[model samples]
Target: MGSNALINKHIDLKNKKILIYTGNSFGLNARRIMPSRPKTADGILRYAKYNIVGLVDSTCSEKNVSQVLPDLNPPNSPCDLKQAGKKIPIFKTIKDAKEKTSANVLIIGIAPKGGKMPKNFIDDLVWALENNFDLVSGMHTPLSLYPKIFKAAKQNSRKIWETRISPTELPIASCQAYKIKKPIVLTIGTDAAVGKLTTTYKLAKMANKKYNTCIIPTGQTSIMIEGWGISVDKCEGDFMAGAVEKMILEKEKEENPDIYFIEGQGSLSHPAFSTTAIALIHGACPTHLVLVHRPLRKRITGCLLLPVPDIKKVIELAEKTVIPSFLNTKVVAISLNTSGMTDQEAKKIIDEIKNKTGLPTTDQIRFPKDWTNLFMGTLEHANIRT
Candidate 1:
């Protein structure tokens, strides 16, 4: 089945009182130290459309979710317990969380390296399934494929939703996206897991106030948050771009948005994971690119031997790579992931990067007003309305 069919087949979030299973990686420290690991949980907490009752993380049990991650309380966040003026609670186990919050759904909230399910997590998943909680995971490891977990779900009449499955049918790319007249802004990165989704999401959210904007989710975490998207990284090598093109065309036909902000994957400079980046560039044929980088990260994540290339080089590579199919594509801005940096430090680095790359730069989450102006400027500079 294609992504649309699969999404329709599995997703049923209605009346779901959710309990996010983050295991040991569920705090602000873990998020700062390993941003990609708890991305699903973070994304859901910040932007999920469902009700998040509580969190299951043994290491941080008995603490409120906001106590552990203060920034999680965005305005009108689903995790906000507005009636009680309290944040969602965290429990050490699924049983405790479910009992306390009456949560009927369990979302696997980590994206470990290689998308592998750790033995402990697998045990927890089985327990949750047997106890009547439906499972939702954005990991590459499909919950439905696990024998014990699948049996438990079947016996308990629980559903399993996996977000990383690629479409069964995909056409080869013919540069179809270049035909779309609307401005398509793709968020490229210096390496994998460097805040591309967050930046794209924030930009699209801001742009939606004035323009009819769409966020094209391209990864598992993005798919979970957006409720529908192709996991481009899971697609076959030949059809990656085609899957993206299909999604864009479908969205255009559905929403007829004024602009598109595509979530990027991996890095064009990284040796271990560059195919998806190349596919997005060729497939989406974006008119504007926003480069996301972490100033402190000198080497590619998970590949110690490979150093990240300079900002200008990656920008030039992204812009020039599309020349054969799409002309005049530009890297319009720089999005710095200054997580763990002090205000002064973030400002200094942001300025340094802006001066070096000569592109408008800011940390989107920390400074939304600045990011909004920068993003709007990018749209105006690109001649994209609003």
Candidate 2:
């Protein structure tokens, strides 16, 4: 928590070459870091992705890097992409492309169609230049196997660029436990008709039906998920939940189950969405933490750090930060959007989480899964939304 602390927390970009690989779908999402003229339709950040040379698709061919990032063209375009993002010319392979271009950084980010990482627009440039992390995009690399990815990078003496900072504090006063009395769900979308809102509504209805609860609407103009408020701007992303969180807490009481289910506004990487997420956590402090990932996690963090980096160890290290003094409670449910996965895969991910950290696997839940109002009707607790 000192100047030295911030200085010590660096990306370690000294002088080394790196090659990051990710899976096809999951990995492809990582490459969507750069923007053409604007990353998002509404626009917020353009600086974070300036350093990315180009996106390369390994599934097609190794020489793709040169093709996509051609001396005159873009990088390799992935199989699932819509050709909307900027591309570089493909080379025989990244190695060959590097040999021709002499580029020091090599990263791979690919994910399945519609299952891409919802990461920041400027992730690649920021992490690549600021942090000493090498990038790669091969779905099976880190997930199933890809020792070569790290081995090659380590042999080149480059550290993977990914780190997370999670701060926890025991809430000062348990405001009120958020219970799903009637399953008041809310979804806000970037688009009007259907976007993330529809997805959120579906989730809410599915959960409500399983739990036998009523669905509440709380969007700008929607008939689904009933709520007392509707957020105006979707480009800003977090409006849906931010607006609803305040409303639910106002009406929630000890006797009634006041479950406020708000949808995340934009992709996680979207700067506005990221800002919105920060606001929602600080403003509402929901009983649960649900991250709607865009599948492009590798580009930003160099790894998908779920449950946010060993909370126990982090707590030990950051207790001095004093979160309990600000927020008034503890105990949270972290839900992940594992929409494109099988139960076995989900279980494996959960198991991996447990193996990496001592936290109970139950604390983290994968998406499209209905908990049936487990959080509701439990106990109402409040944190002094700081």
Candidate 3:
């Protein structure tokens, strides 16, 4: 499915004014910034349909958000594909931002490890609620958990949106997603920020032109863009698998697409998100796996002790240790993110990966047709109608 199909779901964010709360971690400063880890505020600023008035971050106050994170889409502006990003006003506090921009909603923009609320956070949340702004958070720490914030929101008639919480009525995993007679590709990565979501999104949009395909977003940013998805990483460990199963099963029944491209979360070897990865692999039970990686990245993000394993090793690791043991999952293709590499370097790296793993490979951003053609060939060989 595409954005047009999702927009009809009536998300109602078009006219809503929202202020993103990034706190002190809004820039590229190493001490406060986490470039590899996903930023909630960046996602909202990029994907949300709401009128994002400003960003609240005391550390970068008075500067524009684009000045800090040049990678993100410019706040409410159009630019060429390779053009410089635009800027959004930065404020020191949510109250100040609300007053300055007339924003009626406060969105938590920081996505810390474990999704825990920052130690010094409740005061600002309560302040926003008391001031009558509804709350939206992708954090695992729900606002309802804080008595003061919860009480204030109730008293002020404000709604709290917890994006990470899985639906209570999710079905238990029966592994039925794998039983459907269709191609299902899950994008797994060697580490965080390695382009799993981007690869999956591209595949969905491109593949659907010739075949019935739908992308299942499994992260907060992707969910925001797709307009519907459960953040599987934030779900309780025991229920994560079931949550994924339910999502895929429902989409299968509802859309009945010829193929499914499920977005992946963190790396299976990364300590912070391994559990979620395991749940995703078992839950989705995909027939083919597309491994995404940055060929030049040397280590697992946020961990100095763990080195990134070789691409072939990772493909072997997933097949031997995780997927093929239960289902017929193969690393059919590789999606390389060559953001900082030159054309020659990227081509050389792609050739190296293809030779090493004996898998079709492409830099999805630079040469989207490469991956799309690979998927088409796979479908044709499998005798699956496009």
Q: Model-by-model lDDT, in order?
A: 0.81, 0.33, 0.73
Candidate 2: tens digits of C-alpha lDDT, residues 136-240: 221211311233333344444443322111112222223232332233333322111113443443444445444433222332212111212333222133343
Model 3, CA-based lDDT: 0.73
Mind giving the per-residue lDDT tens digits that candidate 3 earns over 1-386?
22211111223445678677877787656334466433566555544455677888876644877675554453423222222254578888887887778988777777677678886878988898888777777777777777787677667767776666666676666676767777878889998778787677667767767888887878776665556788887667777888888888888889888788888888887988888888888888777888999877898888979999878788887776444365656788888988668989999999998888788888866775677787668655753212
lDDT by residue for model 1 (1-386), tens? 22222221466664678888988888766665666788777777776667778889977644887776556666633233331224788888898887888888888888899888777887888888778787878777777677777777777667778888887999888887777888999999999889888788777878888999998989887787777889998999999998988889889899999999999999998886799999998889888889999988988899889898988888888888873442688888899988779989999999999999888999877777798888797787675422
- Candidate 3: give the clashing pairs: 41-109
What's the lDDT for residue 347 in model 2? 67
Cα shift from native, residue 154, model 3 (Å): 2.1
Best by lDDT: 1
What is the lDDT, from 0 to 100, of the residue 246 in candidate 3?
Answer: 85
TM-score pick, better of 1 and 2? 1
* lDDT rank order: 1, 3, 2
Q: Give stretches of model 3 more than 4 Å off.
A: 1-15, 30-33, 48-51, 61-88, 208-212, 234-238, 321-327, 339-348, 366-386
What's the TM-score of each model vs. the native? 0.92, 0.33, 0.80
Q: Show the colliding residue pairs in model 1.
A: none
| Candidate 2 global TM-score | 0.33
Model 3 worst lDDT window (10 residues)? 1-10
Global CA lDDT computed for model 1:
0.81
